[model samples]
Target: MEISCHKIASGKASGPALVSKEPISFLGTVDPETGEVVDPKHQLFGKNVGGKVLIFPGGKGSTVGSYVIYQLKKRGVAPAAMINIRSEPIVAVGAIISEIPLVDGVSAELLDLEDGTLITVDADSRRVRTEEG
Candidate 1:
């Protein structure tokens, strides 16, 4: 199935998804070096986001989170792409500067996408699709 939405970054990626129902705070919650969610309180804590299509509601916490996302990319440990219900300044800026494929305003629920399922995101065209399609 193909779903079109707003493209926040111009790129494309195909990878397994790591879906989260909660917001992510990259600054203190994510390990820039390891790409692991380190905040124990976060539902995704202890999961490594590396190379996956990381999906979440949106971002929270400091704007410095943008730098953390960049750091992850620099360290070669960032998500292959990102999908959100909506895009905020912090996460949007991070995805832009990091060059991570990012799309928002998706109609499907993160849960419906299924964790670990391969999905393709084409941010340049503002579309996402399940591998089956």
Candidate 2:
């Protein structure tokens, strides 16, 4: 499937998708050292975002979350790309500074995509494409 979106960062990446229905707060929800989703309350708890295309509705919580995203990058454990239904400053800034490929303005139906589906994100082109699982 091909999905058009607004680019939030400039880059291209391909990986398995880690779809999340809820918003993410990078500050407390993810471990910068390991890139694991640490929030037990989150649907992605125990899963690692490293190398995956992290997908979610948007971001929430402290603005410090942006730095956390950068920390993940420094530790070499950040998402290959990200796709959001909406783009908020925190997440958008994080992705930008972290140099992670990010795009938003996607349809909510994207949330229905199965986890681990292979997907490619071309932020420069403002496009996301998925292969049949």
Q: On residues 32-73, what C-alpha lDDT tens digit does candidate 1 reach at each position?
A: 999999999998889999999999989988999999999999
Which candidate wins on TM-score?
A: 2
Best by lDDT: 2
**TM-score (all chains, Cα) for each model:** 0.95, 0.98
Kindly report which residue stretches of model 1 are placed more than 4 angstroms away from their true locations once superposed.
none
Candidate 2: lDDT of 104? 97
lDDT of 1: 0.90
Runs of candidate 2 with Cα error greater than 4 angstroms are none
Residues 11-51 of candidate 2 have per-residue lDDT tens digits of: 99999999999999999999999999999999999999999
Q: In order, what lDDT does every prediction score?
A: 0.90, 0.96
